[model samples]
Target: MKVSALGNEIAGPGGPGPGVRLVVVIEDEAIVLAGYQMLFESWGYVVIAAQSADEALGMLEAGSMPPGFILADFRLRDGQTGTEAIERVRQAFGPDIPGVVVTGDTTVTVDRLRLAASEGMPILHKPVNGRQLQELLTRSFKT
Candidate 1:
């Protein structure tokens, strides 16, 4: 088991002994968030999950290390988008932090495309297949 900077033990059933990668997941749905947490941990990633961007930021301990990746639902509560949430976390950490936005919304507007492009983030359509997500994460963290 690995203890986090916040003193929380990090481990999951059938998971690797200690998580080497850290991921921040911003999802509004409780079930989805739980699933992501379980899935990420099982993949040997430590997950920080929250319903909103603000909540995720609040949960982080000061001076904690930056997450290796970020996954966020495009349409969040309180009129916030995944890109915005990613930017918020990046602002706290570093702008080079990579993130992906997952959305159920089929309609993609020009503004949305522009924002994601400008931020160097990719948008994935839901429901994201586990293998696809795993591939994406593996490819992303490999860089």
Candidate 2:
């Protein structure tokens, strides 16, 4: 679904036009995914969202435009993790596609931190506001 900066619905599906920055959001929570989509759209970004990595991959056509950024919940409905989801999507697009993992799991072990660090994905605690997300995007992608 496409939403304009003014929060109006836009026609057409699939990838966006040339030079349009897209953000792919993977969140199991319907409310959270909708919120992210609205927030990103309000920021003038084209958002392609799904509840899981597999679902997102299925929705995206082969050889379609790749997203400029990715956001996924650290813990999904299944045993799949955000890192795994990111890797799966990255494989479809390219390894350079930057992504972030959001999670409410406060007990982040050292091993988990190491894993995220190795993948160059920053983890944001849950209840993330628009400001924090915007700042992180700015710092990471200079958007």
Candidate 3:
């Protein structure tokens, strides 16, 4: 277990530990992934990082409960999009699990937009600030 800069104790694996929330983040880029992990942990969430949908599923199947929410990159390696990924996760968990897709690619394809809308998931543009993410989460989970 490690302590945050603010001195909150983080437990092993499924953590920020008791009473803290959980958020799973999918981003293929290593540096970007690390930044988000740190950011969410700092926000007092147990942040699970995954490079792809399969990896995230594997982690979930390995016995961790579904997260409170999900944040995924719009475009992942091998052409897999975040909308589909989020859909799969929601299917496994529950439709109530709020998900947000983040993308550096400004271009929003019609298909992607429709998919996101159909699932009731929001797509936030990349360079998504910490405050933006925090606000979105607060609005979604009311926590």
Candidate 4:
């Protein structure tokens, strides 16, 4: 559901104009997605919520608008993982684009988790905190 007040206007020869920030969220749960859409937007970020990896990829294929950041759920429908979803989005957007994976999987291995952290891909456990998300987003845009 659309909630962000980030109105889209045709940019010049490039994409969104300066000061325009977009956050793409990949989630399957309708209620959760809605909550996140509103939450991020409240922080002044333009948020887009995708229901699945395929849907996100489809939007990219169809030339959907690019995002400055991505937030995705690790365990998704059809057995797809959040890592895979983020990878595909980065491939389409850019490698430097910052993203975070939200999951409740306690069984995630340490090495993998460390790798994510080192790469600056924060792994946020479920029931994501608004403050943490704000801090992360603040830090992400700084770089």
Candidate 5:
């Protein structure tokens, strides 16, 4: 799965790599969000950070820049699950937008996997590597 196939313009700040035009990251952990944002921005992807599902939804509803990819934490603040947030985003943005769930919860069951599969979304375990995140975003854009 090449990142280019996902409709991302491979133009980073330095005009290097496949430039991802926009990406939304929904995570409760500020530190984690900062890390992801920094990495993606360094690679030239326009990154949008949200501390909660509600904030992310607000951004989308406000017609803030559309994102080519979405990365969410399975657990969130205000008792909202990542799956719920993803559902809302999918409904609002349509299924063409790719989504990925990155979580520390290894207890995800078969039913959860099935649900994610049904939505054509992938779930990645936490402590995600930079390469893995890149790969997930690339694959998502392609799908």
Candidate 6:
């Protein structure tokens, strides 16, 4: 699906501007992806959707426009996990692109959290509140 079809508002009068903030969301669940797209778009940010780690990686490989931030689901449909996907993205795009892993699983261990934290990546519990998502995005892009 076209990224704009997910309800994103292009930044410029006719299209998104060079300064527009872009956020890549890797989610296997259609509903969840739509929800995240809507939320980020409502905040005036452009959203890119990918259904799997491989798909997301392909975009990066093809030199797709870099996103200001990335939000990914912890458990993807494929065997690949969000952490693995984010690591790949970071390796390709560098550590400057901020990322957040969203998950419904509550059993994420402290060590995992520490690893993500060490990389300057944060974890957000699933069923993310729109307000919280917006706030996090704002902070992420501002840096």
The numbered model that scores best in lDDT is 1
Regions more than 4 Å wrong, model 1: 1-19
Question: What's each prediction's TM-score?
Answer: 0.82, 0.84, 0.82, 0.79, 0.76, 0.81
Per-residue accuracy of model 6 over 1-143 as CA lDDT, tens digit each: 22333443333323335787978889988888888887777888777678876666655444345668888888887477777778777777776888888889888888987887787778888678768878888898888
Write the residue-wise lDDT of candidate 4 on 7-100 in tens digits: 2222333434567777778888787887888888788886666777667655444334577888988788898877778888888878888989
Tell me the tens digit of each residue's lDDT in model 2 across 16-133.
6777777778898888888898888788877777888987776555326877788999999878989889999999888988899999998778799789878978888888877988
lDDT of model number 5? 0.71
- Candidate 5 residues lying further than 4 Å off, grouped into runs, are 1-20
What are the clashing pairs of model 2? none
User: Which wins on lDDT, candidate 2 or candidate 4?
Assistant: 2
Model 3 Cα lDDT, one tens digit per residue, 44-80: 7776678888877656654446678999999999989
**Considering summed lDDT, which 10 consecutive residues are worst modelled in model 4?**
1-10
Query: In every candidate, how many clashes are there?
Result: 0, 0, 0, 0, 5, 1
Instruction: Evaluate all candidate structures by whole-model CA lDDT and list the values in order.
Output: 0.79, 0.78, 0.76, 0.75, 0.71, 0.74
**Best prediction by TM-score:** 2
TM-score for candidate 1, please give it. 0.82
C-alpha RMSD by candidate, in order: 5.2, 3.9, 4.5, 4.3, 7.9, 3.8
Between prediction 2 and prediction 6, the one with superior lDDT is 2
Instruction: Write down the TM-score for model 6.
Output: 0.81
Q: Indicate the worst ten consecutive residues by lDDT in candidate 6.
A: 1-10
1-143, model 1: which lDDT tens digit per residue? 44332334544333333346878899988888888888988998877787888877765543256777999999898889999999999998888888989988878697897789778888888888889889878987887
- Pick out the ten consecutive residues of candidate 5 with the lowest summed lDDT: 1-10
